[model samples]
Target: MDESSRRRFLALAGGGGLVAALGCRASGARSELVKPLPDALFIRHGAHNAETRLESLSPGQLVTPNDRFYVRNHGPTPRLSAAGWRLEIHGDAVARPVSLTYDELVTLPSRTITRYLECAGNGRAFFAELLGFAADGDPWRDGAYGVATWTGVPLARLLGLAGLRDGAAWVMPVGLDGDGYARPLPLAKAMMEDTILAYRMNGGPLPMDHGFPARVVVPGWIGAASVKWVGALEVSTREPMVPANTEDYVLLGADYPRPPPVLTTQVIRSAVCMPWPGLLPAGRRTIYGLAWSPFGAIARVEVSLDGGHNFTRVARLIGDDLPVAGTWWQLELEAPPGELSITPRAVDEHGHTQPPLSQQRLNDKGYLFAAPVPHPIRFV
Candidate 1:
């Protein structure tokens, strides 16, 4: 849809009871239709694109601001009404099927967690730039991930209230925005302590674009596992056969046969946030960036100045050491007058290091690019 038509749709959707459902007065203004994103945000690929610029990561709190957080929408953002919304928990494996309203969910015990949600296809552009074979999907850079403080009730708490029948093995969360946008998770992962039905982001009510009434926040997993605009959940006795699990998110490559292992936890990765192919004053310069891993906390980040050649430096971790999964690092060194290439590699607490670009596996979908990304720079 064109920009004007898109705006009109949003305006109509919001003014037409969607905002009222969420217990808010709908403003008759265009601004109420869609939240304006920051001007520096990049349009990686999409009709209604939402992505963060690499430079935006610097000089920000560890928890990304709600407006600056990256958004990956498979369909247009649905303007939902919380008052009319109900999360239905049902399936053959549920002992007591129940439908929960927004007010009822918020009255339950709540908890907060700071975690990063990263797209499995993040950094897919590096595949073509470095390996010469482009993946068939959104050509994302390193900005497809964002860290946030998510607040909600533990999903296990709700499942317990509903009573899971014996032999329940999978939990499938379905969205309200589009058809077949649901994904399933093993019961074990679904019942994890950090798995929550989040109604709030940062500190306020969840934004419409970020899954207003509620959404599932599956920590340490790929972003797809956390369904936005969550409306219902299906607890099944057998593995879910949804297309998201059986087709899209699974790895497919030459070595792996049909239906390779389904993607779960995000891979360890790092990216250079500064000095992006521009002239810089020759002297002392500090190269800084963000690094994260799903397995554990980032143990170390290595910076290579000349395309993994002779000079390599280990960056110093900044801020309080994160005992969890994500942190930032910075490296200070003298830069002589010349053009240069900078690359960063992160090692997680589990000893999993970022793979070199050449060592990355070739998947039909280009799902995960966990290799060190090279950034060009010129010292004047």
Candidate 2:
């Protein structure tokens, strides 16, 4: 970040600027939003955030359409032309600092990845609503995540071009959004071939709301790790201490360490594809949902139509079963109809399954709530 960027960031940091810059819980969110968030597909959180409506999910839909993808913006979406965009590589750890134009980046080498990007606070609201734990941040239901195919140049290739120094440990990709939004990534993770500076999404030029010219897509990690509208990759020997890692995304709770652990890979989470507090006719019906884990592929999905009393395994896993890519599962049940509670639990290949409500603990920000939440529906 340059002096002008530093000054702008400082200004945003002072006087309750953190909430605004981060798009945390706030009023008048629509006033600050820049994208056309249609009500049919999304539930707007604030100016810089819009979650996909899980009810809109259809059977066999493997990829989240570009327009329907959830948005998690640190600041308003930036409108940068590919012709004018340049990705700068610099810092003490970089031996040969260089700036590459949009055209130059795409021409090198490229690969496409089908991965799921989820916010650290994707199910934040569940803590209070389901677990009775008070927490802060957006009240994201289970819809703050989506899977998409991202096409881009590998970060490692770019780092190789820049020539890294011996002690290079952290790679912080800075965004072009206000105050240069960014987060520090470990050198090891940055070197992974899956980590890419994506320029295209779902087979089309990245939308302006989604970082237009380019963005970093860090699969399996918290969405914050994948900064959008990326403008610079600042390499460093020491860990970079920005608001994102230090204060915002860090886990805060009495159960956690004094400093709070910096959130990383997403947890095993599952969600039903029906409306929250939905309705269904009294008869035989099939229940459908999606489940995923950063740890490994989902091994099994169990559904409890009668709440937590008993769980029945889904008929089969559907679509792609890629670990970080997520998979869909469905089951049939005879409905006697009245008021019904449907709970879904997923077990990953590592044997990690969603915890029951009895085992859930409170976290300050309501992050990573992976307990089995019962979806309520009325049969008419």
Candidate 3:
């Protein structure tokens, strides 16, 4: 929250490192969710059909390899064809129904941006502190988040094409991704700046599991809002268009308390993406980590080499310029004078920050506790 602190965390190649769907009900099967490629990958803790990717990198590299980006799916991956897909916008709320074939949508308009996509449950297992119930879903570790360059058309433009009616207050996005499950976006967010309907990632067409033909990328929001393998968009006047769409990833019960009596802005958070235990140099060296904010541009990133006992500010670039989709700030620490102690902290423009995980009370879903998540690294 300090106006003076402006950097987050980082270690290096030698340092350490690091969904929901509720709609299957209240509606009949409207269409089929395309099946993913037979050979697609996933993370399953070496069992339960989960597959994982190991990422190690050099200095100054920020992009997580496309093939290695983490995957979080509620059901099986849906396979969609680029050549045969079309996006339709229609519903009682809309002034007029409109449809766009793949070619038509692309030719109308386009844009591109680089940002991080993180599953809301990126580090659920650590919450094992509560009742010993293993976290569900991918049982994800720190690697469940990744950054990439996404290219596509703006969702706002698409809404304009639909020529929305007065009753059209929101858009319920249903994907060819799963049967009958659709995510709803309030009209404002759906038409906001930078909200994208993407078909490409990192200069290439999206991978099969990532919505091969098309997907919605609502940067800085939880992954649920960015549905993949999209099939249809239904404009609506309803508040809870889909129960699953409204059931967001939330930290329930009392082990964790909602902030300011309202849990909306995601606190700044970071993790070290390099240096496995086997390769630690075993000496004095700097540590690395990444920090981010869902509220706005991260203006201050801090580090505590000794738990939360003390914090030091780090310096970064390409930040404070403006708030962009997937607002993130990168930082590095000097690793201290000797055997450095370290963990990164993120503080956004709104002044919210990450809490220490060790200090957080346990919760049922075990999420967004805002507790600081520290990644440890040693300098050999």
Candidate 4:
């Protein structure tokens, strides 16, 4: 919280009526708050200090520009009154106790998914390989991740409008930028499938730093349990009460202090959002990247040019996958003409392969680097 207290909290949440959450539709959003000019955005400052947000235009575009989308503020950026928002459900298998506002939770019955909002420290600066390029959190050279189209209200219809009596198991979600954070999920990930409570993004009404009147869209876990300015939701069986939502995504052992409990199922990752530093330009070329996996989809994205040694396979998934267990991939590759430095790497079909950035500095914990993107082409 520097830079003039984050520009006076985005000028007090941009004149107190913020709403323009990207992708997934609604309408009308305009309130220019602190866009400290870097071509406008990629994910600007907050959490290890922002400003890695780039690509304001052509980079093979595909939705990521609701004010250059990518502002993940875990604290400081709360300014409500979407006609006074509210959302609550009681404690333990709620058979009673329900509340909703913000246009009655967006007039219920809504679901629009096009997920991919990464930032488990998206490429944590390749875990600072001691600054040979890539260093811990928000040196964020890789565009802090994007891809939206989220719309809301679904978490199984607001947990079936608070009617689940029979030993609830976990679902704690309390946020309004709470200084101590809270996130808990289980009860089968809040009754699984398309978990959303989002208001509307990329179509309108929601952009108070990407979580306007409300937020939560846990599609494919690990985004700090998808909590952002959300009001409250604790219909517990006693569990997700937060401790960094069960110890900072537990899966430790990169030589640390207390780690391990990160159950497998999300490793193969990739990124190269239209040649930012992946630099390219030489004879009929085409290369795009964005891949994911909490375990599923993204079964191929291997581009190597004398770095990770050898490999080539790109199919971008214009078909097959998404049988509903969440695992994303969106690729496009084309290269041929001498002098290169390419490295994209990705593979998931339960095979999970995408690691390098000095191999996460030898076991500190899955920073999950999908290195091989250092393209420097120029053959004119």
What lDDT score is found at residue 196 in candidate 4? 86
Model 3 per-residue lDDT tens digits across residues 114-152? 776766666666566323555544556555666678899
Over 1-380, each residue of candidate 2 has an lDDT whose tens digit, in order, gives: 55576565334322233334335323434344555779888998877799998778776686888778899887666556676677788889999988888889989889899999999898888888876777998999988899999999999999999999999999999877666778999999999999999999999988877877889999999999999878789899999888888898988888899677998888888888887788999988887888988877889888887776788655478877886878888878787869988888899888988888787767898877888888888887
- Among these predictions, the greatest lDDT belongs to 2
Question: Each prediction's Cα lDDT score?
Answer: 0.78, 0.82, 0.58, 0.58
- TM-score to true structure, per model: 0.89, 0.91, 0.75, 0.34
Question: Residue by residue across 1-380, what tens digits does model 1's lDDT show?
Answer: 22353344334323433444333323423322246665566554664456677677654256677777888877656667777677778788999988888899899999898888888889888778888877888888888888888999888998888899989999988776634267888999999999999999999999987888899999888899999878778788988676778788988878677757899988888887763465678999877788888877888988887786533689888864443447888888699999888888889888989877668898878888888877888898
For candidate 2, report its TM-score: 0.91
The runs of at least 3 residues in candidate 3 whose Cα sits more than 4 Å from the true structure, single-residue gaps closed, are 1-58, 129-136, 241-243, 246-251, 254-266, 275-279, 313-341, 356-362, 378-380
Task: Give Cα distance to truth, residue 109, candidate 4, Å.
Answer: 26
Better of 1 and 2 by TM-score: 2
**Cα lDDT of model 3 overall?**
0.58
Candidate 2's clash total is: 0
What is candidate 3's TM-score against the reference?
0.75
In model 4, state the lDDT of residue 179: 55
For model 1, what is the C-alpha lDDT against the true structure? 0.78
Q: Between candidates 3 and 4, which one is better according to TM-score? A: 3
Off by over 4 Å in 1: 1-33, 323-325
RMSD of 3: 11.8
- lDDT tens digits, residue span 1-380, model 4: 22353244334433333232211123323223323335344444543234434334344354566666556565545556677557776675789878777788887778887665655656655556332543334445456556677888777778888888898877767665525255777767767667787888877877766667778878666667778767667776766434564456554564655545643123446655543444455556555455556656667777765655677555354333442222333444455555665566767777777765556443343344455445455433
